[model samples]
Target: MATGDTMQLVHQALRENSLFARLDAADLERVVQMASVRELAEGEALFHEGDLVEHTHVVADGLLRVYQVGPKGSRQLVLHMAGPPESIGEIAVLSERQHYPVTAEAALPSRVVRVPREGILQLMEERPRFTRALLRSVAERQFELLLLLRRVAFFEVQSRLAQYLLEQHATLGPGFPLPTNPELAALLGTVPEIVSRTLSRFYKQGWIRLEDRRVWLENEVTLIAVAKG
Candidate 1:
């Protein structure tokens, strides 16, 4: 895409984002100028956990996954997918920290817009409104992170899986193809084999119907029980 077109897309994405919700047209234009847009192939690493943070990124198109590597070389999935208009690494920037809390990877061929720390600081100096909006954005990101933490900490694997299913069913409706098993596993911070087995169990129990990559819930209540537990 042309640089101008790319920047317009970036501006549009930021406009829809929670952090930039209050930004006016002029402010968005400034952000667009400062932002860098780049495309990443699936499995490409955006940044690693503990890497010095220099910029924040917003997904302009496609899915971005936040995950980390364990000492044993195992991958621990954190944030599954970030759709358009969503920003990442805002927390690191707000805390004035140099390192990232999680590693970011491309879940698909994706477009992302990056805003440098210096750029943000400049914007803050020029516009107090932008500074307030940035702070609000950071706070919202923290709240979102807390929700994910609660989901991972208190819920069992099966329940978490079920809750995920219920959410998809609600969002995508019946007979829609869900994400691949591997994708689901990454989202849940587990392995694909485990996701397959869970799907099998749910299918056999008549709680859901599985066909290839598509999942249909037979009795959402059964999944709800697990989510509630």
Candidate 2:
């Protein structure tokens, strides 16, 4: 259960979320009554892949790293990073899943509101609007995952890397300090050596420049060509 200003803040954030956006204040309050705020220390795992499906959670505070294990079981293929007002594990619960499909870990000290599968089921029965909202949210997530799959399955690693760089450049601008090689590899679904080799090639071709652990986007036109391939 949440209390005081923290509870108020959580309510405000949830109000903005599409899942709860259509709900009236009274209905929203009822939803909160069925949820509990859980705090996770940095590196704590909210759930692991294959764990039995139990509860779904939404971020009340801080960041979550959603990922899957690679074939060797040592490497991680990062799926996405979700933050405040975002829901994780909701899909599994909605789908009546038996086990989790991925792992959710705390990227920072975080607070999340855990909502029981049973409780959501009850809410859906009572609130048609809430059910519609959840369906729409799930549909959007499915399409996003489809696009990611298309990129991973059809595009070459170099093309994906180029696209990732272009996206980060557009979002963060030039001279942005990049994640370590291994982290980049996890995100790009490749090995560190491959990521290093690709970046080196980019540098040699004058498409990008590296300095002091930061990247400079030197030629957008050429990088765009690589990304489109």
lDDT by candidate, in order shown: 0.80, 0.85
Give one digit per residue, the lDDT tens place, for model 1 in 1-229. 8877987788788888766656777877777788888889998988888899888898989888887666787657666468787888777876756899888888889988898877777777887887887788777766866877887788777887988888888888987677777778767767889988988899899998877778788988778897787
Off by over 4 Å in 2: 171-177, 209-216
TM-scores vs. true structure, each candidate: 0.87, 0.86
Clashes of each: 1, 0
Across 1-229, the per-residue lDDT of candidate 2 in tens digits comes to: 4377667766766786778768888878877777777889988999999998888788888988889997789999887778888888878987756899999999889988777888778878998988998888888878867777888898898998999999989988999878779778877878999999999999999999999879999999999999999
Question: How many clashing residue pairs, candidate 1?
Answer: 1
Clashing pairs in 2: none
Best by lDDT: 2
**Model 1 segments beyond 4 Å from truth?**
125-128
Worst 10 residues of 1 by lDDT: 73-82
Compared to the true structure, candidate 1 yields what TM-score? Answer: 0.87
